[model samples]
Target: MNPRKSDWQNLDLLLKSFAQISSNFIYDLDDKKVAELDVKLIESHLSEAGHDFADVLEHLCDNIIPQLSASRGPRYWGFVTGGATPVATFADWLVSTFDQNLSKDGDSIASEIERQTIRWLCQLFNLPDSFDGLITTGATASNFLGAICARQFAGRRQGINVAQAGMANLSVEVFSATPHASMLKTLGMAGLGYKNLIKVDCLTGSESMDVADLAYRLQVSTAQTKIIIASVGTVTATDFDDLMTINQLAERYDAWVHVDGAFGIFERILEGENLSNGLEDVHSITLDSHKWLNVPYESGVFLTRHLDVLFDSCDVPAPYLAAEGDKPEFMSLGLENSRRFRALPVWMTLLTYGKQGIASWVKRNIDCAKLLADNIAQSPNYELVNDCKLNVVLFRPTCSGLDQQAADEKTTQAMKAINQDGRIFVSPGYWQGKKVIRAAISNWETQIVDIEIGIACLEDIASKL
Candidate 1:
């Protein structure tokens, strides 16, 4: 409500300031691996009077910006994270500026953009055109949608209408050899208790699920609604379960199969690789664009072969939505009612970097992982808990002449040191009853040199400990 003449000038100043900060941050990213996270929290309440946008932005830049971890940097290898590509970043800014609702009735063109992007994704993943999908917040949300679909399908098998009747008093059996934690949460959200998840044992000395155990479970299970959760890429170790065998069992038992390919789905892009050979036959699959696609956060995909099942389970009709009819209303198909233009970045990314370009980046990451894994395997001070399959290396520092408890402590301390060094970051995990460090190389910027630096950091920390 200040001078109307000053409004435009002030807006321009704020925009330019933000743009400069963003540009400079990206430009100097290589030099600063991690931000200075030494600032204290601002606990004061909001003021009654609003301040200028420039002042607010300045405060954020001074206080909030430095606390964020540099996950986009070359050596920031943690949590299967990836940095957004230039094309995707630009598209995201456009999305924010346009502020389109991506629903069919809200923005027809934006909705069509999302549909076209979904088609591109299907082609990129080598999936069938008949399969239907929607962009989600992340793998967790995708898993929940997939779970709801499975719940509805399984309830119908037993002459129960879950969508209409709700999971009031139904018992559907869910099984998984190595389900991600998100999958468990999905089951709970779908009204299936977490305690009800029947664990299927893994194959001996391997991270892959035990096909024999799965077959036996299917043979003995009396439940009409059986949902088999298989891992395309496990979180701890990047090992893929035997999808072909699991799908065969599912087909025999008339069960719904859900595969969590959160990060490993990109392995299909690798040359001479069939990482997802039988994935197309599964009932549902979860993929994350933010992980290996090098896109920004809040980008996930939930795809299903059972189009009718998905539509029947998720469709909620309203008087206003009736006219929208037949056209794809993302709100009607998935969880969120008001969705952002999440498709812009994905569409731009796919258009900018076609199959070959994406493949090159993915292959480079896998090669870097192999380089690190090879170095870890040869080092006398470290040993791998699991073989490097895809791009995750699970290894631990060796504490000679120490008990198992002491060795685990030493490994944890080494990981803390690496993270504290601010040059690189790696997470910790327990695999097959052994404590280990998990180094995932999914970032597009990660290279062989980064692998060398990561190894040097690990070795230096381990030696000091």
Candidate 2:
């Protein structure tokens, strides 16, 4: 029955539902059909039609739970990381139950806790304590924020107010040939046309911006030009640009250095205590928790040394809303005025497992690729495109007689053949204009056996092709 007013008793029902949701994540996958569920159900029933909260729970248990569980389970390694640890999942449930407003520290306990969370995160990644970071929607928004901050930081240097004067008046370039899709979004959002931006020649076998090319461009580039973006972990091979070199080049050019390290910053924990050399030099760095840290869904961490620059880029003074106070609220932070409680899950993971745990999980995936790449190199049929430095292993079957198109077709055919079986899933993508299978091992739950299954599946498909 519908409650007359606020329905304070609904909290009991909500906790009950939350319990079931948490319990669903603990079980291993099985072949048995998860109750009687529609394989292609699409319609949602109205409350009057008997699709109550209980019915919805049944539907989730019978449908959504099994699919995501199986699709993203131990043997699944496609696209990139999207696995939720058990503790992280529980933390997410707590956030849902409390429903704490996270936009400002004045909202609730969760808000203040978020401040503490960011402090720990900044320390964990060795980000400057002075460098304040806000949890963004994802890496794409994080990249956009970094781009905006770069524009502002650079504009201020040139005695121009970018916050007051938009990108309409400025001529800016990202200075990257191989940039993440978010980089394009960043530029496009900033009123910089993608086509107008220069694509400097990449170093070799990748789209990573070249330091030498950057230096040459800076030598010729005029004074009014905007920022240059340096990449850490190219999407294709997870290749890292020489950030040290890029910082030096940007310094010479007087361009703001924005580092797009979405999945790359986690590499910081793996490579000794100093993850990013000269990161403090860069104006901003973009981080993605879902990719490497294995959080639930889209959660991005954007950190900048110059907090005033970022604050100016996204500050909104609602005279009626923000009270005149000493402590600037989080709403003055970035693009989001109403932010999600994403910090709960992320903070929980870091607190429960610690940095070493995440570092170890990342190492397992790296080791898997090392083993897989070595195996692929030894095999007669496969050709390793490059050295496996991180978790990604890009390789193609050695189609000796086939033409370029035919070779690509073979790779496509191989991917289709393997995915049809549904035991494992891998996607095909281009590398240096050549068709290849890019196996990125980033899921925290994925083990050595899962990697073996994926390798066997790839080999089996290739042999048949």
Which residue pairs in candidate 2 have backbone atoms (N, alpha carbon, C) closer than 3 angstroms, thus clashing? 268-275
TM-score of model 2 (CA atoms): 0.90
What are the root-mean-square deviations of the candidates from the true structure over C-alphas? 2.0, 3.3
List model 1 lDDT by residue over 265-357, tens digit each.
898877686876788899999999998898888899999888677777777677676425566577778887778999899999999999988
Please state the error at residue 133 of candidate 2 in Å. 1.3
Q: Which candidate should be chosen as best, given TM-score against the real structure?
A: 1
Candidate 1's TM-score reads 0.95
Query: How accurate locally, in lDDT, is each candidate?
Result: 0.84, 0.75
What is the TM-score of each predicted model, taking all chains together? Answer: 0.95, 0.90
**Could you say which candidate leads in lDDT?**
1
